[model samples]
Target: MSAARDWLFADIGGTHVRLCRWGRENGAGDIVRMRADASAGVADALLGFERAQTQPAAHAALAIALPVRRGPLRMTNRDWILDPESLRATLRLRTLCVVNDFVAAAAGVPVLGERDSLVLREGVPGPGSRLLIGPGTGLGVAALIGTTGGDERVLASEAGHMGLAWQGAEIDALHGLGRTRWGRLSWERLLSGEGLGWLHAWRSGAATPAPAPEVASRAAQGERAAREATQWFSRLLGAFAGDLCLAFGADAGVWLTGGVLDGLAETFDAAAFLEAFDDKGRYAATQREVPVRRVLAGDLAFRGLARIVDGACRAPMLRLSAATTHRHRN
Candidate 1:
């Protein structure tokens, strides 16, 4: 692919759908946010892109909130179906690639450099593997696995569906609050942006209606009930993130990205998070060595999309090198 050709980058999620053009570093640079809307479906969301911009002459790399294959991809959070060939034909693009949203996000982590990372702990991380999770419209999970030759492989996960096992007081709280009303307490039940608002409403017994952003904003401005709600949000996120860190064995560290962690300060309290995260008995110390941080910046998704393209492009070279090494050894 020619470096001059502009690649279209997108980040589709449960709450918001965003698309932009490639600027610098293929995508490690700035991106123009064309539109941000509810994740009703790909057809509806990409229409926003279609309305503003014409199709590019070169291939477009797409990063979606749902898992994607080369052909049609069905979104987990929505009913949208993404067909790259049709979209490419319609857009007049030469080629297309669809990647999972979280994987797209993980791809951006390496490109983040020092500026994008906010260190929660000091750990010597080297790229063995990395975990990325965030709570925006929903709780998204992904991991980065590195090959011996230094190639990073992205793995998308549906860990959000793993039922939330509330223990002790948390269990009592669920029962007291009337489990039926909560609609099954999954990890997402109290880990996402919307989940924060739900937690606040339930804990405060407030009848006020507002979105998660509003709830977090209000809490940020000094709402007592909002504050308490955020604390619970933090604790739950820590528990879940720690579980993922264990599952992936991400010695490289864990990144807590998304608008949710950005809004709630309570989630940044390393003491509490590490306390809960490291509560894993024998493996606690090892887990502690894995740093935690929040990704800060608007263009990260764009950069991440670029990373996937670059990595995909370079994959053959890595394989070639491995094959050459085997021949030499033999």
Candidate 2:
């Protein structure tokens, strides 16, 4: 393995890509954020960054929002299809590691300081996994498990794709709306940026959907429909989060982070969220015992990428299948 300083780290999501140079000694350098251009492919974006540097990095680690598998991979929310071998060859990198973006976020949790997170609920820490979930351009989920020997293991999950758990007339209506629009309904369909807009449209009965940010802004300004949408979004998030906690036995804690939630800081209904989170019938007491916190820092994925490069965390290197080869860049 090379020194961490020789590596470049990137966190590629549906909407944006963040890149930075990192070192074990100095941590992360200046971070560069850019809108993700799915049509151009990730390789071009990396190449552009390399060209701007005096010395291009020999190694790279990418924390991508989509699932990382052994073969050609397609992004769920973007149009890019990636081949690990092609990317390595194109970038001339000696080593390339790719991991689920939420795995990177989970890896960052251990390194977070007091100032990096705000506790939403206080609970007795238990000997179980810690869950990291967030909403951005898409939803992300991961579990952090600590072993007795003090080492930690992170499990990445596509839990966002799980079926919606809530039931009601409104939820039924939302499901019908989603089914008509996208042909499928999942937790992510109503728990992400696009989901927020969908909820706003349903609540407002608008023929045209407003953007997620616009909905949040309107909610902040006390618009009835927008406020109701955001509030509903929060409650649903809490319900889903609580369900995940039960499923994963995440009694240690739950950390919430993401651009969507961060943007809803003022408009987010913490009370409603907490109420729904602990609304579990038989396990209500168990839910209340699980601590919940909102991550204040925006550079969580970058921090985790730094840790991976510095040998603090182990991430799988992306492998490509010869049979499934595809060119990701033009």
Best by TM-score: 2
lDDT of 1: 0.66
* Candidate 2, superposed: residue stretches over 4 Å from native: 1-4, 147-149, 315-330
Q: Taking the tens digit of each residue's C-alpha lDDT, what string does model 1 give over 221-302?
A: 8778777777777777777888778888888888888878877755345666777777777888887788788787666667
Worst 10 residues of 1 by lDDT: 321-330
Residue clash pairs of candidate 1: none
Per-candidate TM-score against the hidden true structure: 0.82, 0.93
What tens-digit string does per-residue lDDT give for candidate 2 at 1-330? 334567788888899988888766667788888989643988988888888887877778889978887777788899888777888888877777788899888888988899999989878989999999998888899988874236666777999998787855667887777678778788898889988998899899997778899999999999999999999999999999999999999999999999899888879888888889899999998889999999998789888777655657655446233344322210
Candidate 2 yields a Cα-based lDDT of 0.83
Candidate 2 lDDT score at position 64:
91
Score candidate 1 by TM-score against the native.
Answer: 0.82
